[model samples]
Target: MIADQPQQTRDPQAPKGRPTPKRSEAQSQRRSLANSSSKMSRKDATRRQREARRADMARQREALAGGDERYLPARDKGPVRRFARDYVDSRFFVAEFFLPLAVVILVLSMIQAGAMQTYVLLLWMLVILLIVINSVVLGIKLKRQLRKRFPDENLRGVVAYALMRTLQMRRLRLPKPQVKRGERP
Candidate 1:
């Protein structure tokens, strides 16, 4: 038993009871070693890419922090632009709907003021018809204005967006730049 005590070996090879090396084992070992060598080099690739991105962002921020404010020529940012934004946010609603409402209110007040003008009595039907017409016109104008401002946003993942998205046929009702009466697409 004392003689069967473990023997010490410095030159460590594959451990005992491991699978016997096959004929292709040498080739596989060499290939794997080469792969691991190459892979190690690319381990820092992502870090390097992130570093580059950070550097670029830092440069841009530095430029922006300084007085290097670059303006895009086409992107108008003057008083007119501010006015347009304000109009869209508030005044557009007043113009498109409230003005018509105010007109109707004014007409009602005027008629209630006195019957001094005999034209109202004579053309009461005409006046009523005109008010209705003005209301319809105002409604249409308001709808168009709202559509232009907020826009009709289509819900995502519907049949229209998924299947026939390319065919935006809603524009057919609008006045088109028709190629002559007998022209082809």
Candidate 2:
């Protein structure tokens, strides 16, 4: 069979008649290629790492502002959380004004006069009552909607998540509100 076959021609680009490299030599070359980053200087590596981190942070910030699910933090991920966020955002909540109301109450409390003290106390009580009433109403309604929209979801922390989002000033809420006030989520 060998004698009957014509001679094969090698390409001009072929190695100059050198024998194949040993298995160890081939493996070492592959390892070096795979880890070529080992040759990078420490400063260069750090700079590259810093740039990558900054880019990631920027993407996360954009996602938070624009409600992009893919880059959101784990706590903010998932359709259930998105729905909860939207449900909280779509309505006006008294809890959203808690900070300003608290500040006003704080300033009022500083007035030491008897009538002002009485007024401040009343205002504080009223604000707290309103917040509690509002939160309860919101929770009840949200629970109903959640049940209707997502019956199979694990709803353990979802209500709390929506309530907490309500507590934040609307302007400061992370994964910023996609639904406008009074809009259906």
Best by lDDT: 2
Candidate 2 TM-score over all chains jointly: 0.74
Clashing pairs in 1: none
lDDT per residue, candidate 2, 136-163, as tens digits? Answer: 9988998998899999988888889988
- For residue 54, model 1's alpha carbon misses the true position, in angstroms, by 0.5
Per-residue alpha-carbon lDDT of candidate 1 for residues 44-113, written as tens digits (9 for 90 to 100): 8877998998887675555433312233122222333222222222211222343345566557657644
Q: Tell me each candidate's TM-score.
A: 0.20, 0.74
For all candidates, what are the clash counts?
Answer: 0, 0
Cα deviation of 19 in candidate 1 (Å)? 35
Query: What CA root-mean-square deviation does each model show from the true structure?
Result: 19.9, 10.6
Model 1 spans > 4 angstroms off: 1-37, 69-185
